[model samples]
Target: MMRMFLAAAPAVLLALSSAQAEPVAYEFDLSHTEVSASWVHQGYSRQSLQFTDFDGTLDLDLETPANSTVDITFNLISGIWAGAHHEAFVGHLNSGDFFDTAVSPTAHFVGTSFETEDGETGVMTGDLTMNGQTHPVSLEVTLNNSGETRDGRSKLGFTATGTLLRSQWDMGYAVPYVSDEIDLFISTEMAVPAPAE
Candidate 1:
């Protein structure tokens, strides 16, 4: 009996180790990702701009969602306005009145914590740095789908929405007219890199 108990100890330890899965690394599939910002334009309509150039990574732990993390960066210089007078509008947006790309060329977000009752949805809290200012922001995040590709690569998709006041970041050029509140919309697909031979 004593010998049998000792032999089982090693197997138990091995099983415990295998159960503790490590977080999987995933890179954003830019082709399937979109990050946009919208704000009310003088109550006439809501104006929107897209972040054309950006990159992000996710460390996902399916067994322990709280242990997951994400980091993203946006190139403000790549901001685009989809509207009439496109060039002029984009130029103004990049000027000092708005994002001021010359001064702060990039905005970054680092997720600090994620809270959820179920693994499919959660509130992600992170520090967002923009226009030389960093503030805490929370996004309602949803895991849309996750599966394995035909090539055996893992893939997952998510959608997130949040709102922030432009004034909080000191980019309030037109408060009453342009609407100080800014709404954020993000959709992204992430995938594990193909294994190298």
Candidate 2:
């Protein structure tokens, strides 16, 4: 009986180790990432805005998807308009009427939970902090691809979309005129960094 108990110990420890697998860490590939938003312009057309500077990190647990986590930070001053009147429009957006970037030059998001059915697509819920306000937001996310690159680097790509009310963050300057609802679109690629010598 003593011998049998000792023999089972090794198997039990192995099982525990496998169950506690650590997640893979990845950093945003900034060159391949894009974060942007769009809103209706007085019921006529949808005006677009893009944020150029940001940083993000991801901890992916493929074995247990629920353990995955993500975080992102955007520089509000990097906001840019898409069409004509780019300079003036972006300047106004940075003013108190819209983003009020002068007071809050940065926005941040931290994923609190990740829910998925097929592993390829799912919903991510998190808190978004912008313009001195924090609010819960949900994003529909889709995994574009994941694999090793030609240089032997592990990488993954994803796309996400969501919507938020401008008033929630107290940035409802235009409201019905520029549309209170803002649509968010994001596409990004993340990669594991190489070890330094």
Candidate 3:
């Protein structure tokens, strides 16, 4: 019995080491992150707005991409409308009819599952909460680059796009006039934090 236990010890240790390689944690580089949305304005043209402040986390499993996940929180009050009618449009966006940022100041997204389309393209299904309401949303994502930076930190960059109806989240201020369908896009770079001492 002692000989059998000793012979299996090496194999057990190897298995544990391999398992530890999964699910590498990463932090978003906020300086390079951008989340923007756009929709048709009375069918004349499309208007775009960007969320200026936000943070998020990403857990990536390169070997098993399906096991990855992501979570993000965006400040609803940070919406910026860079248009000729900037102040007026921005105020309308923040008023009770639109985002109602005064009452619900934050929006969130938490990924539940991930699926790969090819090597670097994938889809993430998650729950999105906005205007005090939550609903499921799937974002199409693509890994544009992944490598080590000059400082030796591992980094990954991606762009994601998703479409959702504003009315579904109770932000339907003007359905046909402003367009209920919202096209959202996110471009972000993430880095693996240094290991602790």
Give TM-scores for every candidate, taking all chains together and pairing residue i with residue i.
0.84, 0.83, 0.80
Q: Write the per-residue lDDT of candidate 2 for residues 1-197, one digit (tens) a residue.
A: 00000011111111112354666677667678767788899999988877776665566665565565566677778745466768888888788986688898888887776666666777767778888889887777777777666778777777778888989988888777989888888777666787787
Ranking by TM-score: 1, 2, 3
lDDT of 1 by residue, 1-197 (tens): 00000011111111112244776677767688777788898899987877777665566665665566667777778645466768888888788887788998888887776666555666767788877888877777777777766798877677778888888888889798899888888777667888879
How does each model score on lDDT?
A: 0.66, 0.66, 0.65
lDDT-best of 1 and 3: 1
Q: How far out, in Å, is residue 95 in model 1?
A: 1.5
Model 3 stretches with alpha carbons more than 4 Å out: 1-22, 63-69, 79-85, 194-197
- Give the range where candidate 3 is weakest over 10 consecutive residues by summed lDDT: 1-10
Model 2 CA deviation exceeding 4 Å by range: 1-20, 79-84
- How many residue pairs clash (N, CA or C atoms closer than 3 angstroms) in each of the candidate models, in the order given? 0, 0, 0
Clashes of 2: 0
lDDT minimum window of 10 residues, candidate 1: 1-10
lDDT of 1: 0.66
